[model samples]
Target: MEHMDSSMDIQHLLMMGMDLYRWTFHDNWSEVVEQYKNNAAIHTMPINNKEDTALHVAANNNNAVAVKQLVDEIKRTTSAVESLKKKNGKGDTALHCAASIGSLQMCMCIIEADPHQGHVLIEERNKDGETPLFLAAAKGHKKVFFYLKDCCVGESIGLCRRTSDGQTVLHCTLYRDHFELAFEIIHKYKEGIVGFVDEKGISPLHILADKPSAFESSSNFRWYNWLAYQCIYVKPLRITSHSKSQQTALRGSTADTENPASNYISEHENVVPKNYWTSYDIFMAFTRFIIWPVWEAFGLEVIKTSRKKKEKHVWCGQILDGLWKHKDVAYVGGRVKAYVMPKPGRETDGPKGDAKQSADGGSQKVTADQDKLQGDAKQSAGVGNQKVTAD
Candidate 1:
């Protein structure tokens, strides 16, 4: 009787494990919690063949609510930190999944739940030696990258260390064409990473060199797109405005103590001229009101995309200029010739051909400037009219 009962218990536990796996996979958080309350082992069981826990599934699914509830349940029943630190088949923690998916809320929940080792968690590398910060940059999650960066304040060197295959976050960022984030990485961490070469003998400079299209000379914008690009204006992220206290103080100081209404009337008059609705002004206002809705519905996104593309080209130039200038001071000059100089048969003139098609003033200047920059860079790097073809 005892032997039979033991076999039955084992069968029942297997059944429970299978059910927990299903619930977690489908994001059935309510059922998962109930199963966990009954058997704490469900917290550690491999939900899928990847060996991911319930937390991993919740995080990968970007279900922050499920993550919070699961974290709380684990804290009451088991070790929350250990549970949160569980890795899947690829050795990714729940935080890794959250960061890769760019779920800021899920990352915050996982880190906050681990009161003891939040810093450790941020620095925890997966099987590929990629920290959450590295994954964030690789996936081009700018906000999440900065957020994880904030978590690692004094450990920028360690945080940006070469991951598996000897590739740093900068290499991946540049290779992925995330020039804006790559610019921030280079600008922020100026030391210890200027000369990093991946296992494929590719440095950040090589990645930048291969991307001719990122430069303005290679951009193939239509005439209308160029017009829209010029007219589109992106608002500055940090705007300076008077604080509430300062506004109040200014109002008090400028007001006529004898009569507040007199000061108000004077200020209002200054804002509105006597001919506020002149023929030209009225015509402009009416036209704007009539066209505003149509523009919003049809033209806003296209113009914004053009503006962003233009900004990216600008950033690409800035990156190349900065990195090239820093070459003499740093150790990035080892393989400059093989990478920066074009091979005899390669597609070096692709940008110039595109430039001929573009009639924009900027495109013409860009072709000339790109040639000058390339020639100057080769001279600076001591190639001296000798080209070495890369394999």
Candidate 2:
């Protein structure tokens, strides 16, 4: 090989200096810290095509030593720490990128370099509206989650901040099956769950119920099941007075006209109303609590039998009788009557007497007057009783 020229030697030295800077970032070498202090040229070099300064690359890679060196170099050259205001293509400061990756050490370095960078923590959102904490929670990075949590505590920044879809990090944790993290977040921020609806009007319970596959797939399904069960059973701590008033109105309108007007007018007599909580709401809430545990403990055979189309009426009839027996407990002292409409194969049997049944049944005196009024509409017109009583 021909002898190397001084010009080529100088170019080689420059390339070596640039490579040293890149290697310092890649390996987090401490020696480069000393060299960076002496040579200002190495301080300003970019690594690769990302236009990342030595500081940006080291922070992105979580190289704490290399980051310290670059920070020191900038402070030495510019006589001010503000020269560290480098940003990449996405407009992320080095702190933003490091926090996105859950780099705790680099985060501390940047924060210590300038506590003002904490503002950037909340400001930096990826294309998905994910803050640093959001990404950390999504990844189940508990340390990072708490780090961001402490950063936001008492800082006028709500940790329960919503995503574009209106999902708080807690919602995401639940959806992603990060159950432990979800519980921690909920415990820390109890109100986080209340009134949190997704893009759909679905509440958390609705979301959980609609995704049976997720329920089945979770490795810790028992824990999730128990949590869901508890959530369902824990009644709303504060019931609105409006709901109470609506219940009272329904009770007043539906009370039996035969009862003494004084009895109907009594405040205690009409305390609990019917139809306040619809059957569907009670059924869904009760089923959510009971179905999984009951199914798992005892196989679905009993439930399946009760659920069969042919047996539905029989089961419902039994359930109605059961409710009638415990009406005081079941209905909370409300008026309780059981009326089982005749099934296709069944006949009325002249309204057999049952005290808990409707008054018509308990009366048992099927007078002609009552019969005429009960007559089918088709025959009643011929009877010329234009009273046109309903069957």
Q: For candidate 1, which ten residues in a row score worst on lDDT?
A: 354-363
Candidate 1, superposed: residue stretches over 4 Å from native: 1-9, 220-305, 321-325, 329-331, 335-391
lDDT of 2 by residue, 2-71 (tens): 4568778668657856777667555746666666677665554555566566677777776565676667
lDDT of candidate 2? 0.44
Who wins the lDDT comparison?
1
lDDT of 2 at 189: 42
Give the candidate number with the greatest TM-score: 1
Q: In angstroms, how far off is 207's CA in candidate 2?
A: 4.4
Worst 10-residue lDDT window, candidate 2: 235-244
- The 0-to-1 C-alpha lDDT of every candidate, in the order given, reads 0.61, 0.44
